[model samples]
Target chain A: AQSVSQHNHHVILSEAASLELGCNYSYGGTVNLFWYVQYPGQHLQLLLKYFSGDPLVKGIKGFEAEFIKSKFSFNLRKPSVQWSDTAEYFCAVNAYDYKLSFGAGTTVTVRA
Target chain B: DVKVTQSSRYLVKRTGEKVFLECVQDMDHENMFWYRQDPGLGLRLIYFSYDVKMKEKGDIPEGYSVSREKKERFSLILESASTNQTSMYLCASSSRTGPNSPLHFGNGTRLTVT
Candidate 1:
């Protein structure tokens, strides 16, 4: 079974601080990676996705993720984060089928 | 925009009661998924349907069953609700366009079993 692991459980940072959340998946075959974010009361929305070609994929709201096949990692990054970036971030992987395996998720709190 | 609509935003049920969480999609997507989200568990897939009348169990489908009579709707059912089943249930739909297609999610149904 394929599983996703997110190293950071919770992160607290001041506004304008850089953010990087580590994500690793346990799949060796062709995989699709995604970063989804959930606001306080909003549904989960796609922040970015990596299907093929480019390893560095840019997403909405200044979010980006790099898919490193060698490392089996697709980490989410942002040069600077705002208070609005405070949300729960999830890393998901699809290896064989339409089913997506998600990591435990990282709670990000950006303070102003 | 693709829309996945869950019927309820909040639900409270007693133990041993049968509970149903409804989800409908407007994008004519061929795939619909049911997931339960906890504080640290992220989203665990409970069940998924690829087409009408075709359902498959996901990683954690022990206490749940699903119904997909129509292509646009998928339903998750808890035969006997328990306290452990209390969590935020999310419904998502995605087209079978390709592997890169992201899921469109409903706002979610927060269920509490007493």
Candidate 2:
């Protein structure tokens, strides 16, 4: 069974602070990775996705993720986060299937 | 824009009652999914349909069933709702045209069983 692990349960930061949320997945085969964000009272939206080619993928809202196959990690990062970036972040992995396995999620609180 | 609309934003039902949650996608997507979102548990897949009249059980399908009578609609059914089944349900859809298509989600339906 494939599972995703998000290391950060909760993170609090001031505005303009650099952010990084760790994500790791357990899959041996070819995998597709995605980062999804859900704002307060809003539906989950795709932040970024990595299927093939570039390991470093840039997403919306100045967010990016690096997929390291050796580490089995795809960590989400932002150089400077804004107050509006406060949301729950989830990492999902699809290993040759229609179903995606999602991490527990990280709650981010950016203070102004 | 791709739109996935869930029938209800909120629902309340009694234990032993059957619950139906409807979802419709406008993109004519070939894949539809039902997931439950909880605080600690991010999103657990309950059921998915790859085509009309074709359904597959997901990780947590013990208490859930799905129906896909049409290409744009997927329905999740709970035979007997329980208090523990109270949670936010999200419906999503994606194109099977590509192997890595991202899922478009609905606003979600928060169901409470008492």
Candidate 3:
């Protein structure tokens, strides 16, 4: 079974602070990875996804994630965050079979 | 733009009542999924369909049944709603025939079983 792990449960940061959310999955074979975000009252939207090639992938809203195969990690990062970036982020992985497994999610609170 | 819509944004049902959650996608996607979102559990897949009339069980399929009679619509059913089953139900669709496609999601239906 494939499972995703997100280490950060909650994070609070001031505006313009750098942000990094850790994500790791337990799949040995080739798989697709995705980062999804949900604002307070909105639905989950795809921020970015990794299909094949290119370890580093850029996503919407100034977010990016790097897929490191060796460590089974695909960590999301942003140089600076805004108060509007406050949302719950989820890390998900899909195997060749198309079933997606998601992490527990990290709630980020950006202070002005 | 792809659009997936759930029938209801909020629903309240009593215990032992039958509940139906409808999901529709406009993109003619081949794959549709049903998931439940809980605070600490992330997103748990309840069921999925690869093609019309073909359904598969996901990680958490217990207490849930699905119907996909048409390509554009998928329905999730709770034979008998329970308080523990109260959670945010999410509907998603993907174009993948196998498994490696990005999914588009609906706004979700928040179900409360009292």
Q: If you assessed candidate 3 against the hidden native complex, which CAPRI class would it receive?
A: medium
Pairs with backbone N, CA or C atoms under 3 Å apart (clashes), candidate 3: A98-B99
* Docking class of predicted structure 2: medium
lDDT tens readout by residue for model 1, B37-110: 99888999999999999999998899899999999999999999999999999999999988678999999999
Candidate 2 lDDT over A9-112, as tens digits, reads 99999999999999999989999999999999999999999999999999999999999999999999999999999999999999787788899999999999
Q: What does the lDDT come to for candidate 3?
A: 0.95
**Of candidates 2 and 1, the better by DockQ:** 1
For candidate 2, the lDDT comes to: 0.96
lDDT of each: 0.96, 0.96, 0.95
Runs in model 3 deviating more than 4 A are none
Q: What is the lDDT of residue B88 in candidate 1?
A: 97
What's the CA error at residue B24 for candidate 1, in Å?
0.6
